[model samples]
Target: MMTRYIAFLRAVNVGGRQVKMELLRALFEQAGFKQVKTYIQSGNVIFDAKGQEAALEAKIEQLLQQNLGFAVPVCIRSIAAVQAVLDNNPFPGVIPDKDFQIYIAFLQTLPGKEATAIIATLQSDIETYHLNGKEVYVLMKKNTGAPPFSNTYLEKKLKLVATTRNLATVQKVLSF
Candidate 1:
């Protein structure tokens, strides 16, 4: 049976790499993915395919690199898995506003114990995070400058590839 999966791609439409949503959808469709749809320019693609998440991730990474001429790391999660992240609500009663925001970092793999220890050290008063399975819920308080932590920072500390999206973006992606 085909399973619905969301592929969160890293480094798309950022820096010098720009990928049109239509082109991304086309790549997935050419790779035999059905119902392929892209949510935003940040490279969130939802589709149906028959395979395990890890294998699918690897296949997509290869496909994108071969076609786009650049390595695109992929993090695949089942539709149900994405929904569970929202259902769990790591930051309870914290309404997102201009001053406060929530971001979910979708990880390529579950972090090891040592990595989790490092994550613990990265927390602070303005920035806090909760690691739930392969997902990290980050709560940030907007201050004078850029936030202390970002997707790239977490990836470096954890030594894993991950893509982060605003909570609202994830919600909208699910709606697709």
Candidate 2:
């Protein structure tokens, strides 16, 4: 049976790399995905296909790399998995606003105990994180500039591939 998945692509349309949403959807459709749709320009693609998550991720990464000439990492989650993340909100009653922001880092795999320990050491007053399964919920204070840490920092520290999306974006993707 086909499964519905949201593929969160890393580094799309950022840092000099630009990917048109139309092309993205076309790529998925050409690869046999059904009902392929892209949300915004940040590489959020929702589609239906028959494959395991890991296999699907690898396939997409390969397809993008071959076409876009850069390594585009992919982290996919089923609709149910995405819903579960919202259902188990770590920061309850905390509404995101101008001063505060919430981000969810969708990881390729669950972090190990050592990685979790590293995360504990990285938490601070400005930003905090909660790890539930493969998702890392990050709460940060909006400042004059960008926050000290980012998805790249998390990937380096956790030693895993990850793609991050704002809580609002995740919710919007779900509605697609």
Candidate 3:
């Protein structure tokens, strides 16, 4: 039986690596994923799969390396997971305004206790964050400066691979 999934890729179209969406879609199709659709160049892909999520993630990562000539960490989440992240807004009191944007960092796995504690120490003058399972919700206070949150910082502090997506882009992927 096939299931729908959203795959978030790390290290694509950044640090001097560029991947075209058309090629990405083709590669995913070549990997046996059906209905392969890519969102923004930030490497968001929604596809249908028959394999387990882990197997799919590994297969996608392997394909990315062979097709792109580089290793890119891939995190796959169920369609329900995205809505759950939105529903479980850590900052329920924060007004949803144009100035503030919610970016979710999807971790490679649920963080360990020690890793969670380390992430708890992250200090930000312009943003607030919540670490829950494999999802970290970041509320950025826009006019202060660019959001200081990053996938690298989270991975470094928490010992996990992660990829982030803005709320807007995330919502759009559901429709695709």
lDDT of 1 by residue, 112-136 (tens): 9886688789888788888888988
- Clashing residue pairs found in predicted model 3: none
Q: Where does model 3 exceed 4 Å of error?
A: 93-98, 145-147
Cα deviation in Å at residue 130, candidate 3?
0.8
Report how far residue 100 has shifted in candidate 1, in Å: 0.5
Query: What are the per-model numbers of colliding residue pairs?
Result: 0, 0, 0
Higher-TM-score candidate of 1 and 3: 1
Tens-place lDDT per residue, model 2, 88-164, is 87998889998888999999987887877887987888888988889999999888475555999999999999999
Question: Which residue window of length 10 is worst by lDDT in model 1?
Answer: 141-150
Best by lDDT: 2
Clashes of 1: 0
